[model samples]
Target chain A: MPQGKPAVVPTDGLTTRQRRNRPLVVLHTGDMKGKSTAAFGLALRGWNQGWSIGVFQFVKSAKWKVGEESAFRALGRLHEQTGEGGPVEWHKMGEGWSWTRKQGSEEDHAAAALEGWREISRRLADQRHGLYVLDEFTYPMHWGWVDVDEVVSTLRARAGNQHVVITGRYAPAALVEAADLVVEMTKVKHPMDDGQKGQRGIEW
Target chain B: MPQGKPAVVPTDGLTTRQRRNRPLVVLHTGDMKGKSTAAFGLALRGWNQGWSIGVFQFVKSAKWKVGEESAFRALGRLHEQTGEGGPVEWHKMGEGWSWTRKQGSEEDHAAAALEGWREISRRLADQRHGLYVLDEFTYPMHWGWVDVDEVVSTLRARAGNQHVVITGRYAPAALVEAADLVVEMTKVKHPMDDGQKGQRGIEW
Candidate 1:
């Protein structure tokens, strides 16, 4: 159970306490800066400390093209890592998107996104991981598209024993205030306005 | 002439009225999704008008590492689209990061980021691009790192004849509100957290 020590010796080489102290992380979603990479780094760091982890993805609706793209991209990365070469497994929980088929209206989108959040909160509370990355969890709130109260409650419930990371643009003021650490990415310069397009591998 | 017209028409394919109207777009700084790619899509939509365009990139700092990675990943895709070979040309502006000799403070990092922004904005205002993308421009603001008021004023000053895009997280609230359109990317799910590391041609 001790870190860097033989079964009998209590050398100062490493402290088991440090290893056990790795907290859970909940990553709130933001744009494609380095959230995924950062989350991966944290998870990898936790893994090194002998911690068990679980991942959950919440979305407004499964039917949206963007959702599919996000899922495929994330899975593609997962395949490269696990080297298992099988289909990426994700537990899809929540009511499907009703807004897509409904008349395109602000209300419709808001309702659907809110429903998605409730489902995600329910699922997130059920699992335990050293790090929990709530990816893109802010869009609903950012757009006034989801219920803030429900989300706050869910996060509060997981406050203990979980180092959560929430990555998203327009993070709610409340959420920002709650975070122990906050990182914001600012776009300084890029190459695309010059007529460059998104390459499959790099931009996605 | 109107759309779906014959090429030999005397008035040309586009009507005079149509030619005079150019789309207002929010472009990316360099890559797709951030600001550049988004701009490209908008430009492509406008290409039907056959409008003569200008594109400019501000070289504020040398992007040796990010550039190399982007080149390796986006080269093939760029060749296919533009019919040009090898790495995409990236503009490097601004002086690079300046660090304290003894310690690294948050302020120091912010100052460096703002220096980069100042140079980027200088370039954005001087030229006329059908669309302009200010990439990685938010670093200064996100870190509380730069003089955001200046950036906002400069951008506001240059309004018409060009569609501008501000990418990166931590976009100044002033800029976001001023933007006719703001699209934020929230990370909902990622492969990296599932033990997948960054792979070549992906996540670059």
Candidate 2:
């Protein structure tokens, strides 16, 4: 698409600014690596615009955190100290965050994901953020841990100008139908095809 | 693919560390957004790893710069002040960088793009940065302004552990073939499809 120009203008009876300024529900889903990375990039953009960024990461490797977490944390600190950009809050499951999985209570991944979903739902209700990143959220919906219909309805009814971006594989049909923008990251080639192991920095 | 696991392992007779440490030529291409966004996200990861980042943007709209540039510049400043992350250098085709289009001569788009490619080539030879982001570079290749064979060979011959990421639509088949990791961002759905305009912070 051309910069700032929609291919077609709807007769939705809204002004150009109104239509442009409306919040978005962007979904990045498919079998490729850049899903979460792209979502983090959106967070960077949101931070620059002084939009409060809330990232809720779910069911990732328990071993090591992705690199974006540390970078965003630094950005958050920068915002607090110098007020250069917007505020940023990074939350990941299994990290003992206040909203993280209940310790030793929900060992099952599905239940833990469901718990995370509930926390996000509550925050959405309270209008806690301008941009919400549900990184790797599709697994729960795909695995039947989270109700797809419930998610769709909740997002549809979300209050305020909160833009939500969800990244993961197998995004539910209902959620995609309701989303404002969706990109499927498809793999054309991978270093692993040549027996190369994933590298530091680039992979994490 | 599972985290840190390859689907198939080739018999390249190299140690895991050596294979993993090898530099990658990553290409992001297709008819959707998130190409450059994903690349910038990788730059964030690279910075965290103390890898110098060099971003070269080509053929962008003159009206405004993307949000990532400002954020990266701020990160660069952070690194310079506190020895935190890594050094960052952002270069765009216009706006007159020292290596940018030499002002009066290159009136045509192709010539300017060619000049930009030459600058990147020189930087690669110098091993100037650990990670190079060729933002919207495929446009030049697709338009035949830049040579794909030369790009592939130069990247293959590049010294040191330098990772290069090229992003844009309509990537040349040869370049994709040469790339170690290639992601095609396909549009499952777009806000423009619903007659909505792109918004700041999200679109930029």
Candidate 3:
């Protein structure tokens, strides 16, 4: 058995392996720190499987370099040079994604986020990556910059075996309902509660 | 700022940077899939910081080759050869641990798990690694194999800045209280409920 018994078995006609092979739209949402980090962890597993990993960070502060960014960048380089693991493409709201938009063309944050979604949508259609990490992507949807219904529908209708994992708080009910795996990372304890500040290596 | 503003600032006498450098004991518990994967992800970040990583898997199923095992093994090799990232040590309940124990010399599962805990306790006393990931360690405590109070006390009294992350369901209250950060991975939705089975890559 691949895993232990399920809590509730459905009457879906598909065989166990068929059901197992289904693409997953995993949503990690809650007011906690490990959502994105867990998604990155999932990306590591997928990468081990030779899955092309693509990470799109929606809240792209230029100065906010999380530790995963550097580690994954090194992984991407390793893949490029040594053909070890799978390909990794990390795109934040930086100049590395595309240069079609002018630097001072007055492109607001919302437009840029929407454009990022568009790019991801195109990739989904083409089934570019085996695993997609939409880090902090639910914020734009929660803020109404991106349409939740459209995201749900697009992900539902995505082509091929592309597994997408989205991380952020306040995930829309529609998206949650559409997700195959939804993990609400509730905080049982946090150092911040004791007035302690976040630390490096652990927080990032 | 290492991280965004906290929900509440503490009155601790330590400065921000001082508080920031303190080690963390993170606990991932509850009925979910991504607990170990998330801990592995955190280890990746710690590895990027050049933190020596020590992962001890108490559930020593030779058949269960989790994706992170291969990925992190590659990272360990990369660090060894190229001096990139950090060093990693992975120990399972296999023969590689030591030669003191005879092969299948009537070592029951409970005794094996207890020995594993004792070894980890010794390592904690020595502050052996920058990050210690005790994968699936709670089952031993829950099953009355390893002493929960001992684990709690040992982790609390751990020296230096060694970060320890324990993941499993049925975490004892003492361990929860001793943890600096605790995440309860509640499953909002799961494909298994729909009669789907756990697959490779995602489930492993």
Q: What are the RMSDs of all candidates, in order?
A: 14.2, 2.0, 2.6
Q: Which ten residues in a row have the lowest lDDT in candidate 2 chain B?
A: B97-106
Order the candidates by TM-score, highest first — what do you get?
2, 3, 1
- Identify the runs in model 1 with alpha carbons over 4 angstroms from their true place: A1-32, A40-108, A128-130, B1-204
Error of 3 at B97 (Å): 3.1
- What lDDT score is found at residue B150 in candidate 1? 72
As a whole number from 0 to 100, the lDDT of residue A65 in candidate 2 is: 40
TM, every model: 0.37, 0.94, 0.92
Clashing pairs in 3: A195-B10
Model 2 ranges off by over 4 Å: A1-4, A62-65, A100-106, B62-65, B100-106
- For every candidate, what share of the true interface contacts is present? 0.00, 0.74, 0.68
The weakest ten consecutive residues by lDDT in model 3 chain B span B95-104
Query: Which structure is stronger by TM-score: 1 or 3?
Result: 3
